[model samples]
Target chain A: MNLVGSFFGSSIGRKIIMALTGVILIGFVVGHLVGNLQIFQHPDHINGYAQFLHQLGPLLWVARIGLIAAALLHIWAATVLTLENKRARGGDYGFKHTIQATFASRAMRWTGVIVLAFLVYHLAHFTLGVVQTETFKETAPLNHYVMQNDYRVAGFTVVKAGTDVANVHSMVILGFQHKVVALFYIVAVGLLSLHLLHGFNSLFQSLGLRNAKWSWLLHKAALALCVVYFLGNLAIPGAVLAGKLRPQTAKVAATAQR
Target chain B: MTLRVWRQAGPKALGQFKDYAAKDLNSNMSFLEMLDVVNDELTLKGEVPIAFAHDCREGICGTCSLTINGKPHGPGKGIATCQTYMRSFHDGDIIVVEPFRAAAFPLIKDLVVDRTSFDKIMQAGGFITARAGSAPEANAAPVPKGVSDLAMDAAQCIGCGACVAACKNASAMLFVSAKVGHLGLLPQGQAERDRRVLAMVHTMDEEGFGNCTNQYECSAACPKTISHDFIARMNRDYLGATLRSAFQPEAASSDGGGA
Candidate 1:
């Protein structure tokens, strides 16, 4: 193996790669959450935000390619490490007892798989505008909604700004109105949070950045972050289900779909 | 007391738990001594006594190993099997005994395993050079007290395989890293520091031991309570050494060998 290949081929080296890629994905998750939370603002804010991203064009694809690479590498490292771990353990001990390993630590592989599955569905639902076609803002005959500057007036297609854009603000609210979709999102994000619970802390140890001194802080911080991320994700679907969140102009689009 | 011992005739033989009555045991006797009493009776009866390993019987040697009731060294912290007294177990308690299990440390008999895989890792790390002349003054190579203490902590590893037995993945990273850290901390260990960490880790992976997941089970099972910090230290050193060797090929060879 060449020097670079040899470096990444070893056990520790594989883990180092996993940690690096994990950090990239983690950054994306946080950034994605921040963008999604703008749903609570005026319809114009989030719609304009979506419009701005659409304008990024090629840059967005570059970011997407980087993210896809990170996810693939992360899965690759995890598979190699998990299989090696199973083989090294060999036969089962007659009596097995776990002392200090947490449930989150042991559940990494299972949780990761679930999160990846969720990512696929999430992309289908929002990015491709394929799943839940009825609620997709960019769907035919009901795609355009005028952006209104007013926050509380409820953005309508006949509003003051009159600039046509995909109604991303209502699409999110309308999609979550489906109980199954909302529950699935909640469950999937919950598993992703569990995956992050162990992963966020483990990334530090894999990179040798964590020792006894900062271990406690990193552990607590990772837990807090996972909980916060999970709750923030949960709140959106939860609010829509509870009728606290409503589409500013989905009535017209919903009737037009019928 | 009833002893549920894992009995295997040989490496290829199938193993099973065979119960033996260990009667009239004194709580004051160590776990090994109780086993001795049982073995004496078995020898008199013309039966094969339980096969196990022991040496100094002191915790320092790391020679004695057993998984007493699923925990290495039997339900105590920072002490080996030899140090576990019968007082810890109540009368008539069923104590289960088994050997340390791992792909690398293949079973030798009922309770003994081949741990020479550790020796292979040590050989890969190699030895530090020391002059054969009269003892140099301690001040000649001044090592900070804290640094020396840390080295001693890593040096406390007795090459015991309990860490492997305790780890869920059967990883030997803690053991390998201990050897790397103990020497790498001192001035004497610097010349081969890069090569040592790199080769030792390479050998460790080749040995079929699992990778560390930072669970710290090895540290918890360690008789000497060696910190898991050594693993992290070794990781940092390994990364730096790999990068340095690639960038400065000349330094890698002069230091002893290319990683």
Candidate 2:
């Protein structure tokens, strides 16, 4: 076998793959959360941000493909390793007891499966526009232009034409406006938090980065990161359900008029 | 006291727990000695005695392995089954004992498992290929105190396979790590260190041992109190060895043109 193939076939090699893919996925999730948080900003800011991404065109496709590949590799490695672990256990013990393993560590596989299922639902709901929420509304592309002039002069502001917006801001707000959809997202993100809680430290260990000197710090960092992700993600749905976020129709109309 | 023990007549026989009552067990008796007392009674009654493996009765031999009440070597830290005393248990408590369970170590009968797979792993590379010569002076090749201490710590593994019994994954990474770290830290073991780690790890995988999930259960269950740090050390060594071997051909070819 080729060197790469042989390395990947080994247990440590597979673990390394899981770690690398996990890092990539974590980056993507963090980036996604950041962009989603823009819902709290002005409508023009988020819609323009979406337009900026849409203008990236091919670069956007590259990122999408890379994320899909990383997700697949992560799931593949996890399934294979979990199966191997199960087989190694031979049979059930008469009476089993856990000594040091945490609840998050024990629930890793189940949380991973839940997060994966949520990923599919999330993509279908927002990205594919397939699983429409109760508050779903079809939005048309709007031409965006910058009117940069002295704010003191109301009508004398200069309008510069820009690219069209995809109305992603409206989609996010309306999607989360549905109580059931928002509740589902809250639950899924909670599972994702659990998965990340155990996975970050596990990733370090799998990649041989864990040692007695750094294990304590690494575990604390992992827990902190999980909490950040959980709270950040949970905030969006919480904001939407509480009627704190609203569609930026007035701003969009003003931009169109300008 | 009520004793619940696993009973399997043969390698393929169905296993089950059989209960036996002990009337006069001294609290000062070690757990294995209590088992021996129970066996003596059974033999006197013309019944097949409980079959368990033990030698030296001390903790060093690694021969006496049992999962007592769902714990490897019973409920204590840094002590084997032979070191556990009946005093640790309440008088009316029911003590459950079973063989160490793992796909790699199959049950032979009762609490005895065929741990010869560990022997196979050891044979693969667990030794230094040294020349038989007169013993050299102790200080001829002095090792740093920290390195020697680490080596000694790793070398304490008795290969009892308690780590496998305690692990949810039944991973033997701790055992392989101890073997690899013990030798790799010594000067005499340097010549074949790379090959030793590669061969030992390959054999461990082939023996149907699971992958390490960094759960630390193996270290917790270890009779010798071996640390999980050795596993990480071995992981780093394995990566280095694999990469070095991968680039060895280019390195060899480049060496010919150097001079």
lDDT, candidate 2, B48-92, per-residue tens: 899988897889999999999998999989999999999889988
- Evaluate residue A10 in candidate 2 and report its C-alpha lDDT on the 0 to 100 scale: 74
**Native contact fraction of candidate 2?**
0.56
Off by over 4 Å in 2: A133-162, A250-258, B250-259
Question: Per-residue alpha-carbon lDDT of model 2 for A1-258, expressed as tens digits?
Answer: 345864678777777788899999999999889887876866555655565566578999999899999999999988888899999989778877887888988888899999989999988887666776332233332333332222111454222234344566666766786799899999999999988888898887776778888889998999899899999999988987898776666664343333
Cα deviation at A165, candidate 2, in Å, is: 0.3
Pairs in steric clash, model 1: none
Relative to the unseen true structure, what is the C-alpha lDDT of residue B253 in candidate 2, on a scale of 0 to 100?
Answer: 57
lDDT string, candidate 1, A14-118, tens digits = 888999999999999998988889898887877877776776799989999999999999999889988999999877788787778889888888899998999
Residue B211 displacement (Å), model 2: 1.4
Write down the C-alpha DockQ for each prediction. Answer: 0.69, 0.58
Tell me each candidate's TM-score. Answer: 0.94, 0.91
Name the best candidate (by DockQ).
1
